[model samples]
Target: MAYDEGLAHRLGEALGALPGITAKKMFGGIAFLWNGNMLVGVIGDDLIARVGPEAQADALAQPGARVFDFTGRPMKGWVVVDGAAVSEDSALDDWIGRCREFVEAMPPK
Candidate 1:
């Protein structure tokens, strides 16, 4: 299935101001990379966040969030937040910010 264009657009706007961020098409969706690291993306309207391993459990506990399972197995350090949960710009920003925090801390690739 194709990913949501609207969500992808929103993600672009959200991360537009950040330096070293780029958008790429992958996994049938649009991925936002920070400093060459995948930070967030939109998968079928859901928001995929790379919150890192240490914060995975906490991020998964949030409403409308779940494991980012693609190939019948869940990926560690990532979560997919339901699109509805991020309908508000503020909510979307929050998720993006969290993902950014984790990605920024990593050594640039």
Candidate 2:
């Protein structure tokens, strides 16, 4: 499964100089981790955002967002935002910020 390099580039720029940011290949795409935890990811031009369980419903209500169901089962605390929704830098940043807030609050793995 080939992911979108263009989206990955935009994600990298959006993550500019963020400490503990790392890229890892997963779910047939690239995932960005914050302090060793999964934050956001680029999967075929879409964004996989870990918004946490508490924000799941709200996150799903966002434009172009849906439950992260790469497999048969849906992930309760994650959402996949369509590429169109995050085409703009600001939109991407908003999603990333939401992911950061979730990842940052968790204990070290």
Candidate with maximal TM-score: 1
Question: What is the Cα-based TM-score of model 2?
Answer: 0.95
Q: What value does the lDDT take at residue 88 in candidate 2?
A: 88
TM-score of each: 0.96, 0.95
Clash counts per candidate, in order, are: 0, 0
lDDT of each: 0.91, 0.90
Q: Write the per-residue lDDT of candidate 2 for residues 1-109, one digit (tens) a residue.
A: 8998898988888886998888999999999888889999988879899999999999999999999989989998999999999888899889988888888998766
| Candidate 1 residue lDDT tens string, 1-109 | 6998998898898889889989999888889998899999988889899999999999999989999888889999999999999999999999998897788889888
TM match of model 1 to true structure: 0.96
Scanning candidate 2 in windows of ten residues, the lowest lDDT window is 100-109
| Deviating ranges (above 4 Å) for candidate 1 | none
